[model samples]
Target: MDEGAIEIRQLRFGWKPGECLLSIEAFTVGRGERVFLHGPSGSGKSSLLGLVGGVLLPQAGEVRVLGQAWGELPASRRDRFRGDHIGFLFQQFNLLPYLGLLDNVLLPVRYSRLRRQRCEEAPAIEAKRLLAALGLEGEALLSRPVAELSVGQQQRVAAARALLGRPELVVADEPTSALDEEAREAFLSLLMQRCRDSGAALLFVSHDRRLAEGFDREVALSALTAAPGGVQS
Candidate 1:
């Protein structure tokens, strides 16, 4: 069986003509491994995640998830595949304002039929379990609007939401920016534990080098810049 790893062969992307934003000659992320990617601002970290999550198409070569080429799939199929295979956590808590915390966490199910079917329990139950695991278990808070929660609580809620469907790949972009040292460590521990439990490969991107120490491996995009605006298959 093919392993659930992200494999890239000569992947390149550019929004504007003649100026490439990202180009990876070759890169692979193994299952159940935590990888920290450190980049300064405008290093194309977000773009790399966007490619892996199937949000942006590669200009050349291929991006494969679990051995299936992302570019080969149709746009609709690609979206579904991304939803089922990759979980994205952005710095800004993108939770819906009107939806309650639990409801916000269940957003993936609304777009992903596969996740909805494979969910072990009803989504509400699953959300509660995830919430508890992330250390937020007050019954009164479950139904509360996200605006009522502190930034740290919102971060944990986002973590729970990202990990809810048990995606093979979890892409987190500077998620701990708002956290203090103690809170950051606690959050990292829970997220790493959950990723291990789910057997997901965490490709966490951060601008801070301190966070890289906790991960199993680290890779910098500067090394993979062999091709200026090209990708080789």
Candidate 2:
């Protein structure tokens, strides 16, 4: 059987040693699962994404992705592991202002040999395909600098970048927060469909509870971390 996409146990994390931002006994996101993780602002949603993505490590306990524990890997290896297996959609939609949409989507291939190798076709071909799938088709649009795109279009570009190379896991940090209700729903639909096509598990973080529907499971950060048993698959 395939390993779970994410697994957490007795996890504790905080920027300062004594202050605890998150504490959970167990939490898991299974392979190919679409999990909506919601919580109020300042509830450690982004922090949790950082932990699972290996950008930050818990002070105690395990954060395992694809069955590999984050703490076990050295810093350099951790970076490589995350680059190869996890795709992140930051809240800011961090695209290079100067780079065109296609170039931005190909960024992962530049960083990760594994992801590059995973591309079934040429990297550029795959990037264009993802762009088209995300509703950013046409050379006029694809060739434009992402900086010129509107908020919604840039968000789609970011999603395409995250979905490129078909990483095993994708994490979105309030990706749809800027969109209106209709646009939010549309973006979510496209993002989820791309993840499904790639067989990548999605852990989408948001403060909006109304956006929770259609996910395979919806979990709240407070409940997951505060509950005695924590959340499990």
Candidate 3:
């Protein structure tokens, strides 16, 4: 197997003292692999993602992304590392309401000089390519405020943003929950194709098993947690 895109060893985390939300002896996702992380409603799925993304530190053990331990980095460095190496798609499609869609998609490049350097074309050109791939076209649509787009359109914009500059790892948290069945499948197809094209490992967390069929592997977040009572903090 190739080097791990993400690796966790004896990981443990909790929001409050004496309350363990997640415990995982070992978890790994290999380079270019797509893994469906099965996380039901009350599972510590979100917490796991936060740890992997370096938004939350483990109480014990380690999280390594692309072979570097996140805990070793200072907070500012960790944030820059995350911007350069990871792309995130949240369930809520967190777009700046006032920004134009293209500008929103170009945000990562602004923050990470490494990501900007990785772009094959100018940032504007690349943004357009990604948005077009996700089925948003025309200068008019690109120029419109994100607030005016429908939920599905906004979701596509979010996907495009996550995919910009081809970060090494793409982490998505229940990104398809708001879409209808057909829309969900279509979105997944596009997202997966883009990840593969960019050689990015995908860690997609969702409760929907049907979406797990074509993934390289399936992981149950429930099984990873040793804490009792499905404690999610």
Candidate 4:
């Protein structure tokens, strides 16, 4: 199999009719690589991520994941492709308020049979193992409503959910923003360890430069984006 996990070529995207928010000549992320993507606000980081995750399609050029061109897939197939191969951790955690922690973690399995079949253990058991790995344990915490958990704890839960089915790619968007300095470091350590264990490629985005040190590689979105006047590079 080809080693590249993600590849983009001559990509262009914009929300408004004639205003371009992002333009890139090329970008690639290898399999199992942990990459930190840094960009200031309005640098189109989220738009880039949306393209990578198949939430948005580029107006021109290709966005391919695991060798499949996202533009070639129909809308339903793109959604399935995302569910099957990409795990997402949004800034807000995006957990269901009514579901228990375990159920939240098992959500992917419920939606994607590919994810379900990838697990050797039952989905519930695997969920607990992932939760435990991320420092949430015991029946009490597992059964508690996610809305009641602390910001850091909720972040961990989100990480566990993302890593549950061993997806080939994990995209985390400002996951550490709500954490204190100490907690942020701890959470990142655990998140990296889990991603390594699963051999999942990680794309972590943040404005904080301090957290960029331990990543295998880093890319600044500003360098890749082309605004109205010219390309920043």
Query: Which candidate comes out best when scored by TM-score?
Result: 3
TM-scores of the models, in the order given: 0.93, 0.95, 0.97, 0.96
CA shift of 225, model 1, Å: 2.4
Per-residue C-alpha lDDT of model 2 across residues 147-210, encoded as one tens digit per residue: 7888888888888888888899999988888888888899999999999999999998888899
Candidate 1, residues 82-160, lDDT tens digits: the string is 8887888888766788888988889888888777776789977887888899999988988788999988888889988
In candidate 3, stretches whose alpha carbon ends up further than 4 angstroms from where it belongs are: none
Task: Give, for candidate 1, the lowest lDDT window spanning 10 residues.
Answer: 224-233
What TM-score quantifies how close candidate 2 is to the native fold? 0.95
Q: Where is model 3 poorest over a 10-residue stretch in terms of lDDT?
A: 224-233
Give model 3's TM-score versus the native structure.
0.97
- How far off is model 3, as Cα RMSD? 1.3
> Between which residue pairs do clashes occur in model 3?
none
2 versus 4: better lDDT goes to:
4
Ranking by lDDT: 3, 4, 2, 1
Residue range 26-77, candidate 4, lDDT tens digits: 8888999999998866667778888999989988889999999999999999
Better of 2 and 4 by TM-score: 4
TM-score result, candidate 4: 0.96
- Which residue segments of model 2 deviate by more than 4 Å? 227-233
